[model samples]
Target: MTNSNVFQNLSQESMSLDQVFHNIVRYMKQDVIGNYRLIFGTDSQVHTDHTLFITGIVIHRERKGAWACIRKVKVPRKMTNLHERISYETTLTEEVVSLFSEEMKQQLIDIVLPHIYKGASFTIEGHIDIGSGSRNKTRVFVNEMVSRMESLGLEPKIKPDAVVASSYANRYTK
Candidate 1:
């Protein structure tokens, strides 16, 4: 919801949306053109007085390597309900995915749009923090969240499978 770009890379410098897109393009063209997946996901941690949210964009090149950019924001409001909290996390993920998808579309239009899902082989997926295999209360919202993501044309992945959100983003949520 914040207007300013606040994502930071673990190894390099922080990046704006444009920078992220350019980096991905560079990686795709120089490192792995037809073998990579772009993923967007979010996770959150609720404290007594606030909530910390982390949204991550991961670029994974098949058997080669991976890089991710993360944004961490602290909301003054606290989200306590399990369902509400999980829903909020999914919403955050959606926001990031929307922006990312738009940027990537513009960048890849001339490069791979005509050959989408074919020669280029670039993929975009959304990873939700909720999963069916967990004892966590968020499991109940898996179906709803996945359906929403699917409606947006993003392949949805859940915990165990959605390490981008559950594991990576979660690591920085605190």
Candidate 2:
């Protein structure tokens, strides 16, 4: 298994965590008076010999537009166990979120602190790829994963609500 700080999107590649932080700051600064959300999530695809995990980081300007990037991690062996795979995805998401230092977060928060009275706000969310649908196999793990997100002081999202993990990250996992 390998872990790296590099992240990339269609417009940029090989961005260090500091660059990613500045990119997020630049986007938020564009319209400080608007509402915004930061989301982090991860999805994985297991191949015959290894598993590829993609963690997506997105900063949404709430219905206007969003800036997103992803970091990939490759585990040197196939991971077919459902619980293990799901747990790893969540772990990856958490790992990426942890890279943002308290000061970095404060930088983003400070951008909106002044405009809060005008309805501007900022929120952070963690999207876990699991779901709670009774018929879904991942249902059993929903509570555990959501609790993990909550412990990080983030809003937890799953399945239908977790498009970042289930949708954005999943698309490039191949």
Candidate 3:
């Protein structure tokens, strides 16, 4: 979710997409020979006057360290429809994913190309804030969202595995 085309992390208040890309590159350079996971997710909260959405991007080095950032988007009115809210969250996450062009992805991959034999690898995942568990109201929508993400050529994670959406982004939606 981005209203101003900027994102922020713990250290910076405002950053353009290019800046975020560079930051990701800098972070990966710290350990170019490690496994990398690029994850994106979105969560939303409905308030009296507006609905706040937060999309989180997490660059995780597998069992190693990670870097995360969030983007906020505000809808002018409360969103009470469960399906609509969930659909919008998925859209927002997809938007962030679109920011990574093929060239950029290849650039990141090139960082680990030399050490591929030594376990260096890269993968991208889209974390939807829905689950397929019984008793979960959101379960009904999981397949649709997962299909949408899969169309974008990204692996999808849900619920317990969707830490970026369910845990990180959800925290800021409040």
By TM-score, is 1 or 3 better? Answer: 3
| Deviation (Å) of 38 in candidate 2 | 0.5
Kindly list the per-residue Cα lDDT of model 1 for residues 1-174, writing each as its tens digit: 343466788776678888888877777666433566788898889988888889888888777788789877677878788887788788778777777666566665445555555645667789998868666777778889999889878889987899899898989877
Q: Judged by lDDT against the true structure, how good is candidate 3?
A: 0.93
Ranking by TM-score: 2, 3, 1
lDDT of each: 0.78, 0.93, 0.93
What are the TM-scores, per candidate, against the unseen true structure? 0.86, 0.98, 0.97
Clashing pairs in 2: none
Query: Candidate 2: what lDDT?
Result: 0.93
Off by over 4 Å in 3: none
The per-residue C-alpha lDDT of model 3 at residue 123 equals: 90
Q: Between which residue pairs do clashes occur in model 1?
A: none
RMSD of each predicted structure: 2.7, 0.8, 1.2
Ranking by lDDT: 2, 3, 1
Per-residue lDDT, model 2, residue 43, is 96
Query: Where's the lowest-lDDT run of ten residues in candidate 1?
Result: 108-117
Report lDDT (Cα) of residue 137, candidate 1: 71
